[model samples]
Target: MVYDLNISAGELRASAGAADTLVTDLRPVLKKAVDDLTAASSSLRHWTAGPRMAETGEGWGGALGALRDNLTEHARGLRLLANGRDIMEQEVLSSFKGW
Candidate 1:
């Protein structure tokens, strides 16, 4: 059985661009959320649940940071894949040029 793999470098690059944009857009929003959470928790410091709230905010911030990092890595991987695909396609075409 012959199997064909169809890959579009343009689409891969586009997806990578989209991921990059998402990360960029999320940065400020994430920062604002973390800052707000921290401030809110500080205001509640006199309450019994203040420390817990702070901890929860920290956890949320860490999770958001991890998500941003993952998205960045994903975009990098996609870009690399697109570059590799373009190279492979070029090599294949060059090989067939003399035929």
Candidate 2:
């Protein structure tokens, strides 16, 4: 039995690039959303549910932060994988130089 494995470094790099672009584009939007939520919560301070709204906003901000961090790490991992694959491929090709 033989198993074939194929990995495309270019595709992995492209995916990483896309993730990076998404994070870049999303950063400002996430910040604005959190800021808006905080502002809204502040404006409702006199209401009975003001504190609850603030708490909910905080939770959402935290979740968004976590999502951003996870995506960054994913992009980093993809880049590392692509680099490692590239290095391995170079090494393998060089091994055949004498043949």
Candidate 3:
């Protein structure tokens, strides 16, 4: 197995910036989707369902809620990765003192 790693400070910064932008752009959309799903789930309580159908609706709502939570967490992780890269860039610059 062979591994080739090549990355400059400017590239790191640019990639980090792009990641930050992506996280910023997606977070709000994900948040709104979560909110909408929660609202819809709440409204589902008003609908009349048969014994089996009611259980199905409950399961569906739970799945939506879980998906929303996962998306929210994913956004958070993306932001963290971007920020960590930025921090690492700073640390490298400080260590070199010539960059």
Which candidate gets the maximum lDDT versus the true structure? Answer: 1
Q: Over all chains combined, what TM-score does candidate 2 have?
A: 0.88
Q: What is the Cα-based TM-score of model 3?
A: 0.52
RMSD of each: 2.5, 2.4, 6.3
**Model 1 per-residue lDDT tens digits across residues 1-73:** 9776776888888999999999999999999999998998999999977887899899999999999999999
Instruction: Name the lDDT of candidate 3.
Output: 0.62
Candidate 3, residues 13-87, lDDT tens digits: the string is 566556556656766776666566556556675665343455655566567567656655665665666677778
Off by over 4 Å in 1: 1-5
Q: Is candidate 2 or candidate 3 better by TM-score?
A: 2
Decide which is better by lDDT, 1 or 3: 1
Worst 10 residues of 1 by lDDT: 2-11
Per-candidate total of colliding backbone pairs: 0, 0, 0
Q: Which rank order by lDDT, best down to worst?
A: 1, 2, 3
Q: Estimate each model's TM-score.
A: 0.90, 0.88, 0.52
lDDT of each: 0.93, 0.92, 0.62
Q: Which TM-score value belongs to model 1?
A: 0.90
Select the stronger candidate by TM-score from 1 and 3: 1
Q: Which number leads on TM-score?
A: 1
